[model samples]
Target: MHLHCYRWTGRGADRARESERRPPHPAFPASPLPPMRTCDWLLKPRTRIDASPATVAEAVAWLTRRYRSAAESFLHPDGEARIGLDLRLHLAEEHLAGGVDVQWGIWLRGGDFITAAVICCSPNRHAPHPCPAAS
Candidate 1:
């Protein structure tokens, strides 16, 4: 589970437990995440696999690999590609707090294909999650 640390990030429970020696994902939010009891959430993948790294640097690298392709897809040869922020963070091990829905993503613009993103949202106390639209 790509745990942000202690809690699940996208990695499964067993996986996180297996690597107890390693300090969780090492990127947990300082305060505390909103009370997100159930893992019953929705997932939107831009591509087949989702490799959301824990840090911004890693995410950059992940995007770097696709730069060439992105360049080719731009509507214009001189078109520039952009990287949109898609960070999902929660405070460390503490009682979850507010009900702010988090939908993180790594957007890409330009190239042969338009920019695409992967968004993941969890349910909160107020309303059902994976709820209405994750499109």
Candidate 2:
């Protein structure tokens, strides 16, 4: 497994330059913009994996648990607060042939869930696509 952590500064030029430096994964095409709202601004820790769905689910579950616990530390009884989870799953043919790339993220504001989403993108070369309308 390989891990690549990114820190987002909310700069479009920075993102574009970064993208230019690294070619998209052969099995997971790149997008002009990510498919989820938070995904566009939140930092992502890249994980390279060749694993089954069960393994992926397990990893997500673990991260969810940890996020919940950490979120509490950021909470205050008399002020606004925010916490979230941002996950990106990139699967190659060698790992899961024909499997789509997945991106998921959620945000909690003032201890309430304000957003949650999951998006899938085709693992093929094509023009960039936009994210689906949020529900």
Candidate 3:
């Protein structure tokens, strides 16, 4: 149930400057502030589905239904299954105009669900590696 969170830098320098201008708290000395993020305060309740015995077809169906237009599935070199989704669409129909992109994904291995995540990144950046790296 661990969630990996990341900071999102907005469209341009303006957002960065806005964050820098905030006064430091009395207890801490003035320093550069972290960039603002779109999901800085996301508090939505989360539900975990145990897919231990679920067939590949069932898992695919569930992910497809949940993610709709955003879902993508792939097979790893080690035979694990992976599913991912671009979640920003939940907020707006169009891609942000030079804003961050938000995504979520899961990994299934040995009939058990392994890892899941929500990632936020700059629109111009790509994942550091391939979806399910080649051995």
Candidate 4:
């Protein structure tokens, strides 16, 4: 199984800043800095809003709330954002024997609409292990 990250940067340049600064997520240790990489999606000049948990459903809500275009029409009513974890495929394999760790991010375009989604797997010291491309 493969994971895919998706973002919708509508009618503009990409606008995701790779921050060397960490925002205090428990998953990261105090000493180890977050790896730097281009965000899964970058929609420029669009408004961005911050949310808690940053779930897929939130992304869907964003798109539906702001845009009436065909692109924003497919948001699931459940608002479950797609979970494209590279490890989901190996869940029954060796990796599961020891358990695994994962990280995910959702960037919204126009503040309410999601423009990009990113999911990084283990050993992401360099960059996030990208999933399949989003439409």
Q: Please provide TM-scores, in order, for all candidate models, with all chains considered together.
A: 0.31, 0.24, 0.19, 0.21
lDDT of 2 by residue, 27-94 (tens): 22233333233223212212211122334354444434434543553334123222224322222222
Q: Rank the candidates by lDDT, best first.
A: 4, 1, 2, 3
Stretch of 10 with least lDDT, candidate 4? 40-49
Best by TM-score: 1
Off by over 4 Å in 4: 1-49, 52-54, 69-126, 129-135
The residue-level lDDT of candidate 3 at 8 comes to 21
- Order of models, best TM-score first: 1, 2, 4, 3
- As a TM-score, model 4 comes out at 0.21
Q: For candidate 4, list the clashing residue pairs, or say none.
A: 4-132, 7-115, 7-116, 8-115, 56-81, 57-79, 62-112, 62-113, 63-113
Encode model 3's per-residue lDDT on 87-109: one tens digit a residue.
32333223222333333333322
Tens digit per residue, CA lDDT, model 4, 18-91: 24223233322221222233231212111221222244334334333333343344344223334322232333
Backbone clash total, candidate 3: 0
Q: Kindly report which residue pairs in candidate 2 clash with one another.
A: none
